[model samples]
Structure formats: structure tokens, C-alpha cells
Target: MSERGRGDRRGGMSRGGRGGAVRGNRGGMGGRGGRGGGGDRRKGREGNNNRQAKKKGGSKVIIEAHRHRGVFIARGKEDMLVTLNMVVGNTVYGEKKVVVEGSSPEEKKEYRQWNPFRSKLAACILRGIRDIYMGPGSKVLYLGAASGTTVSHVSDIVGPTGAVYAVEMAHRPGRELIEVAKIRTNIVPIIEDARYPAKYRMIVPMVDVLFADVAQRAQAQIFSINASNFLKNDGHFVISIKASCIDSTVAPSTVFSKVRDELIENQFKPIEQISLEPYERDHAVVTGVYRPSKKEKAPE
Candidate 1:
């Protein structure tokens, strides 16, 4: 593992620019948008049928829209709800909140789609995270909020007042992110590189939790630099590391070891290390406390 100095400036970073940045999760679909190939007309037809059904369904779980993996179903598929849902509905809005909506007078509609691959909160739970600081009103810096799938869940968890800085450097994904932000005013979209936190600092407020899913080699260093400027001292830092991106030449264990050491050097305390199997291949999720001055503990 090379010490890509902060701002992503390191031995391996020469291939890419040296600015810190994060946000993008197509749930491992390779970040390609919904422009599914080989069936252009079919896409339009399917959308029409779904919309027609939703218009007549009336307070039902209508298959409202289509994304890459599946269709978006909604009960109040009305214009207002549709508009609101587009914002915090499927993106990470940075607030930690749990909304209990009742489908019927006696029924409870309490649930949020948990995408383990994109959002580390679900990944950490699968990895057995005892306590995630992502509950109600928690401020979060959501990195890699591609297309807003997992970010929507984060918005539900964080609620309204709290904010989430959804950062994405990719233009294609950033467009969708902007749409999601338009409805969810709390989420501020920054179409800048994550390696350079200062560049996007004006849009960013202090955050209690920093969640990153950037599949870059110098991720640990990127997180460190971002944390110094953004994360609260005792706040939480959740990172999803793609083993293949780090050092493909060495074993996964070696790569993880090197990255963990670097995090320690940067003053982050590693509390949990987890592997995401069904969701991501040979990928790992790490949850750590940002301790800028304390002695780092041994890797768990």
C-alpha cells in the first residue's frame, strides 16, 4: 500500500488526479444509468403502463417507476409524493430518522429499503455492527451517492433538519443526484472531486457521521483528509473498501492490513472490519472512530 498522501497524492494516485472525493453506488451495477441496452422502445412502453396503473391504483402499492434493478413502488404515487420521493425517497439525505406510516388505520407502514452494497450501515449490520451512530437526526457526509438508492434510506434515517452532503465526481451519476437533491432540499449535491475537500467545503457543514463507498485505491487517505476538515472529533467514519482496487498484486489480507495501518497513522480507531459477500465480492466494510490524537488499537 503506497501512502497516497492526503488529497490522493501518492505512488498509485499518479494515474488519477490527487483530490479527495466520494459518492457513487450503482449497487455494483458498474454505475451505468438506466439506459438499458437492446430495448429502447420497450422502456418507454413499460413506463407508460406503470404510470397508468399508478394513476388508477388509488392509495395502493403501485409499481410506480423503473430503475436498473427493480421498479419503484409507491402508495401515494400522486404528484406531491412523487416529487418528495424523488428527493429523499431513494437517496442518502444524511439525516437519521425512522418514519412510521400507517398503510391502514390499524396497519403500520414502517420500513426502509436497506441496500447493503451501497450504504455501509446495512453492510455493517450484516458484518454485525453492534452500534451505528446513524439513528435520528445524525448529520452524515454520504460519499458516493450514485443515483440515490442507498442515499434515500440514509435520508429516512437522518430525517429533515439534519443534512447530508452527497458528493459525486461523476457527471452521469451527478445528474440523478441533483434531481434527488431538488426534492430533498436538505441534501446538497457537490459535483466536485472528493480528494479535494476544500473545493467543496462551502456546501458542506459539520457532519457527525461520514459514510464513504468510493472504490478507489487511496480511499483511506481520502477519508483521513476529509475527516480532518469535516467529521466531528468523536464522530463516526464508515468506509466500504473494494479489495480489488487497493493492491491487486497482494492478497486481500495484506491489502486490508496496509490500509488499516494507514488509517491508524491518520488517527482513526478501527473498531469493526466486515466482509460483504453476497452484496459485494471480496469487498469489506470498516467502521471506525475518528481519533485524531489517540493511540490506535490493533485491527479487529
Candidate 2:
């Protein structure tokens, strides 16, 4: 399969720099002033006016269900891809939060903005990939879950009924992932090398979906081995490949073609291949089913 044509970078969603940098709010008025002073009163009035103007200028946001289940779009000042927050009042990687008021106080719902620049999965979605193979109540096995950035979003998509087994080899990011898991009970953080799935076999079961974002040179092999151990037959697999990491000498298209062949040889039926351009250069996301079940013919 060929990668999708590269499109212009989406401008509406917040762009968190590479490595999931925090995108803090900018252009806010700041100053210190004495209480009950005329300046303070004037500033208060101006603040009130600004809030009123903002409210008047179409600041009302409406949440609409996205094509993919468990994913949503917040439309207002800017359209942003969002997932319902599993843990209320917590920010995983400093993403923008959108709160929607319900009929009652307890009914209020919050969503976390998903940045494509910070996540390959998000990039894939924005690039109009046909299927994610994941939704609410899907059991996911996530490899290379660094600091639980995308893992947190996956947890949100899976909701409470589902689970995410996050594996990270490095201790530094593993620690952060552990902290993220502590808050979201659905996530199980396993700090171990993904190359050796047997080491953590006891903690992980055969999952419905396997996602790998490990940019290692042997990433295809790693995905194949892990899929063999933890992925159920006919289960879906989504893997992000960094062409440079695999081989900088060859063209990215060549690298993707080679990886697609490797996956095919390893019992993966590739469904779609999409380029993660604008958000990530020279990167591609490949998704397909593992050991797909054969269809039975109709009675003749």
C-alpha cells in the first residue's frame, strides 16, 4: 500500500512542540496592583469587558462525536480533536482542556485536546486513515509508551471498562508513566524491555489491539515478536515508523515499502499506510490486522 499524500499542517489544534512540550497560554494581561485602587477597579472593568466580549464573540463550544468512536471534536473558536478525560482536573502533557457544562454540576464533562504534533496516532487520525481499530472498551497493548502522553489519551478513549498495558524500557519515562497510571486506574504500566515479551507475559493478556511507537531500528521485529505473544488472532495492530531511525540512507518511501513487506512476511495484513507529514517529517503509520480470520463461503 502507498502512503497518503502529504497535506498542509492543521492550524486549529494546538501544536505542542516535539517531544510533547508544554504549550502554555500566552498574551494575557499581568500586573500587580493595590486592592480597592482606581487602577485595579479600571482593570477589573476591562477584564469583565474582555470576558463579555469573548463570550459574545462565539466562544461557546459544542462537542460533536468524531467518525471514530470514543473520539470527539470540539467546535468553537478552533476545532480540536479531543477525548473525554478519564481523570478529571488533570493534565497529562499540558494540553488545552475544554469543559462542557451539563444539566447539573456533577454532570459536567471535560475533554483533553489531542495534538497531532505530539502523537503519531493523532496525526494518523487527522490524515483521514480509514480505521483506528480502537474504541471504547478496547483492550490495548501499547509499546514505547514514553511518559504516557499518547498512552493517557488512549486510556481516555478506552474508558473505564477497557484497559491499556503500557510497556516502557527506560526507567525515566517509566516512572512518569507509572505516575500517570496511578491517576488513571485503567492503565497498567510495565517497565520492561518490549523485545522480551515473556518477561512481562504474566501481567499482559492477549489484547484486541497492539500499538507500537518505538523508533528503534529493529522496530518491525519488536512489533512482530510482541504481536506473536500478546496480540489475539485477527486483532489489529498500529505501528509508527520513523524512516530515519530505520535507515537514513534510503528514501522514506523505500523504507516504508520495506517495512510493509516485513510485516506481510510476519503474518500482518496491512490495511492502510499514511504519512505523518506536517506533524512529523519522514514518519509513517501502518495499520492492519494480525493473522486475520478467513471468511467462510456462502452455501452454493
RMSD of 1: 15.6
Superposed Cα deviation of residue 267, candidate 2 (Å):
0.7
lDDT of 1 by residue, 1-300 (tens): 101001111111111112311311112111223444344565556555544433442122322331211112223222111112323223243221112334564442222334354455555564555555675567889887787666665665566766778888899989988887777766788887889999988878789989998889889888889999999888888888888898888888788888889988998888888777665677777787886456689999
Encode model 2's per-residue lDDT on 8-60: one tens digit a residue.
Answer: 11222344445442322222232344342434555666655544544443245
Q: Where is model 2 more than 4 Å wrong at Cα?
A: 1-49, 53-58
The parts of candidate 1 lying over 4 Å away from their true place are: 1-110, 117-120, 292-300
* Number of the top lDDT candidate: 2
The per-residue C-alpha lDDT of model 1 at residue 279 equals 55
* 5: Cα error in model 2, Å: 34
Worst 10 residues of 1 by lDDT: 2-11
